[model samples]
Target: MKRTAEKVLSVISLVFTVLSVIGSFIFVAIMKTFTEGTLRTEIEMELYADPELTVEDVDMILSVLEYFEGFSWFIVVVLVISLIATIIGMIFMWNEKNPKLAGIMFIVAGLFAFILSPTSIMLYIAAILCFTRKPPLAAEDQSFIDNQYDDSMRPL
Candidate 1:
């Protein structure tokens, strides 16, 4: 029932979060390798043609590399943070505790995922499920309620 659903949701969230993190790293690596290769080729061409590249030219190349590296790191950081938040939300949801807060965290994570990751849709669904459902009652509480009902129904 609700417990089974929660378990399934939490496991899916964990799986998706891990996949998103891995995908983010792969993306950054691919972009870095491609850009660096192109820059290297351009630098080699300039050096070959000029036979004496200027300091300013080197500085410009370095600046471009620095800018792109910074941008890539920023994207990675944001994606990682978002995935981490989703993981935390999954943990909270699994425990059946602080569901409202878990839902909010999942929403935030989903938004961040939308910006730069692939798990946005799944995370959004998880968030919605969290928000709409109430936690299942404890077994003891249910048993107590059942005993009270039985006592009332018995003959005097």
Candidate 2:
């Protein structure tokens, strides 16, 4: 039963991990396109609409946008790193070892991804459950412990 539980948890973790990685990549790509395309155009238009705004103001605004663009790249890098972590966690879970910690790490990563995009919330919840639920040990492994070294041997 315990082995079965472990296998179940492993499958769950693997599924969620893959989801998180794919979601992260898609989110980062979409965000980058939006920021570079529509968002940049909007900012430029906003600056142009204000004729009273001096050249210094426009320069400052552009500078800010440039900084934002740079920061957005950092977010993409973070997403890549998160994808790697999720993959590692999936591998650990599939092995049916002490993957609880790995599962928890993946859950936290998924939560971070969720903050960036709500689509990742499902993966976050699934990974959390995978980490928290204790897997039952194999029957043979638990029999000795479960039997309590024979009830008859107990001191009355």
Candidate lDDT values, in order: 0.70, 0.61
Residue-wise lDDT of candidate 2 within 1-156, one digit each (tens)?
134444454455446555655665676565566458777688778887899998789878777656665766666666565556566665666666656766676666565454545424544654666667776765565545555556768876
Instruction: Provide the lowest-lDDT 10-residue window in model 2.
Output: 1-10
Q: Please tell me which predicted candidate would have the highest TM-score against the true structure.
A: 1
Question: Would you estimate the TM-scores of all the predictions?
Answer: 0.60, 0.53
Kindly report which residue stretches of model 2 are placed more than 4 angstroms away from their true locations once superposed: 1-50, 111-116, 137-156
Per-residue lDDT of 23-139 in model 1, one digit per residue for the tens?
A: 768867865764577766786566556747776776676677667766777767877777788878877777777777778888888777664444666666777788888756666
Q: Output the number of the lDDT-best candidate.
A: 1
- The local lDDT score (0 to 100) that residue 57 gets in candidate 2 is 93
lDDT of residue 39 for candidate 2: 76
